[model samples]
Target: MSILITGATGLLGRAIYAQCQAQFPTLDIIGTGFSRAQAPLVQLDLNDAAAVRAFFAKYQPSVVIHAAAERKPDVCENDPEQTLALNVETSRLLAELCHEQQSRLFFISTDYVFDGKNAPYAENATPNPLNFYGKSKMMAEQAIVAINPSHTIIRVPVLYGEVEYLAESAVTVIAQQIQQNPQSSHDHWAVRYPTHVADVAQTIADLIALPAAQSAGIFHVSDSQAMTKYDMACVIAAALGQNASSLVAVPEPTQSAARPYNCALKDTRLKQLGIVHSRKFDVAIQQIITRS
Candidate 1:
């Protein structure tokens, strides 16, 4: 079956597009992007209603993985309008279009949906987002289910893998900061599960392989290893053969936007399907660092 992947130029979307091609070589794979669109990747603005509809009509993809979004908490906080338009409005439009075309939509959501008070969140847990980014995704989730109950919502935690630049991902940005300034400080108050993008892409592919009825609704995909920004920085320091002691660990909230301490997503639904893929943070980060 043919597949459409939005935000193809993005970190996660790029990985998803490549992974899908590797897994399903014979199937049609169309990628959409804005700034970085190339020959194979179409330049389609998801915010434009007419363009999105026209493109969907032309491709008639059986499945659409909507991975495009404004994920930064601070950015979303700074410009709520843009965040709402890109994250929430875009999903609303895609949901409507996918339903009209009878194509299943797999929306990429964030673990930021929950407050830090809760430890491990189940699929059925109610979202109490601590940031605008998370709230937008939560609203988009509601819109998607309302527009098309058969659609899927895949919520993932902090992601890092195969970046075009270190700044592209929060996980890799730690390395970038340390490289630039060995005395850089990192937040130690928050705990995060940094899942590899490839694993999440593989999880999506496995879900797409299942029947629509079986894979519909919410699913959490994340690595089990927990680490704060300080923890990640230390790991990066070790990989660089630098002393981890040089990095300062700030124990209070530092960002402009409010952040949840820990949002550990429980993949009970995925466990039931017997589909899982994960890797150790230290080992994977080393490979990524070496590659860069």
Candidate 2:
């Protein structure tokens, strides 16, 4: 049984692929992406529907783990049509293709589906996205469900680690400040779920191994804690053996792309499935720092 992983070169996707390879070495993993160093890339562009169909028809993968998307909120807001086309339209096309191929699709979603006014969103909560990016993702989620009932949409929140997206979003940002001025205390206040990318990826791999009846639905993947941007910086600082109190809270962005303050999601359903991980925020931080 071969599994097709899109965005295999991405931070989360690569992490998931690595963990899956470790756990299920015998499973055929067809890693696909445009990047050469993305490790087993298929050179498949999502926008090209015919190409996507051709690739799926050729592979006929039984399990599809789709972790690709235009994730940046500001980028999405800057180009709504492009964002919708990439995030929504591409997913719609993939869902249809996966249905025809008889593949079990597991699409990555975000906690941003909720406006953040409500913290610890549940699996069944009504999505009230406050921004265009969230709207597009929620649209994709709904569309994926409509296209294939066998699909599993996993919603993860503000992910970080020693790897790809973390460097861009959290690790590098904190390390830069620490390197520049070990005493600088600014740029904080954005709160998030702060999930470990490796953990989220492993959770996906675990869910896919479960029986179809058990893993098919919406699942919120995140840490057990809710933290502000400052909190995250503190974690990073502590992990790097720096001073946490050296960082200070700054005013958050009022209106730019879109971010949910309380997008922290509860993993109750995943917990019920005995799918637990290192919920200790410090453990995840330490892991990232060690590898960083």
Candidate 3:
């Protein structure tokens, strides 16, 4: 049976596809995308219910990885209605289709589902989203659970990798900045869990490879350790063999969307599933550096 992945053109989706291809070489993988990429893609828009339903019917995916979302907090803030329409409503449609097909749905969620007042939120913690993006994601989570009780909701932290667009990734952006301005000091202040897309992808692929009974319900996927944005910058710098001091601390910039200071997640469930994430910040940074 094929594993169908939505948002295959995006970073997370692409990473998941890559990991699946590497780990499960003989498994069939179908990728859907809004914009075309190197992978085989079915160009179907999630917002268009007809297109999505048709894709679902034709593909008949046994495993559906829902990685598509309007995740930019600022963009979602600017257009809350669009965010809801794309993230929540579209998700409901997909969940319904998955249920009809009896496919296991792995829904990608966010740490932003929390209010950020508490660090390292648990899987069972009540989600009180502090921003529009968070609200939309939370809505999707609820809708998916309502539609398909067999779904797996995987909540992830902010991701960074080498192959990214718009300089949106913290790790990539910091690495580039350090390369350009090796002597500048603005890298040590911003810190996050900084989960590598590869690790996140690996975890998801591993889950999908498991039996249905082994893969169900919500799972928090994050690093074992939580680091600030500043700490991430220092790691990036050190990986490049540059002076970590060159990455200086800067005041927190104003954000259009509310940020949860405590967006970190604890992955006790993932650990129990034998998927312990022990990638240190330095090792993750080096991976990015090597790949970059």
Of the candidates shown, which would achieve the greatest lDDT relative to the real structure? 1
**Which residues of candidate 1, in runs, are more than 4 Å off?**
none
Query: What lDDT does model 3 reach?
Result: 0.80
Candidate 1: tens digits of C-alpha lDDT, residues 1-292? 7999999999999999999999889999999999899979999998898998899899999999999999999999999999999999999999998898889999999999999788899999999999899999999999999998889999999999999888999999899999999999999999999999999999999999899999899999988999999999999999988899999999999999899999999999999999999999999999998888
Expressed as tens digits, the lDDT of each residue in 1-292 for candidate 2 is 8888888877777788788788889988888777444435677888888898888888888888888888888888999999998899989988998888777899999888899887768899999998888999999999999987769999988777656433465444666676577676654555676777788878988998898888988998887676776676777678888877767777675557767667778888999989987567787667766765
**Candidate order by lDDT, highest to lowest?**
1, 3, 2
What do the candidate models score in CA lDDT, each in turn? 0.94, 0.80, 0.80
Error of 3 at 265 (Å): 1.2
Q: Report the CA-based lDDT of candidate 2 relative to the real structure.
A: 0.80
Each candidate structure's TM-score, on Cα atoms with residue i matched to residue i, is 0.99, 0.91, 0.90
Candidate 2 is scored at a TM of 0.91
Candidate 3 error regions (>4 Å): 164-168, 179-191, 251-253
> Worst ten-residue run, lDDT, model 1?
93-102
- Listed per model in order, the count of residue pairs whose N, CA or C atoms clash below 3 Å is 0, 0, 11
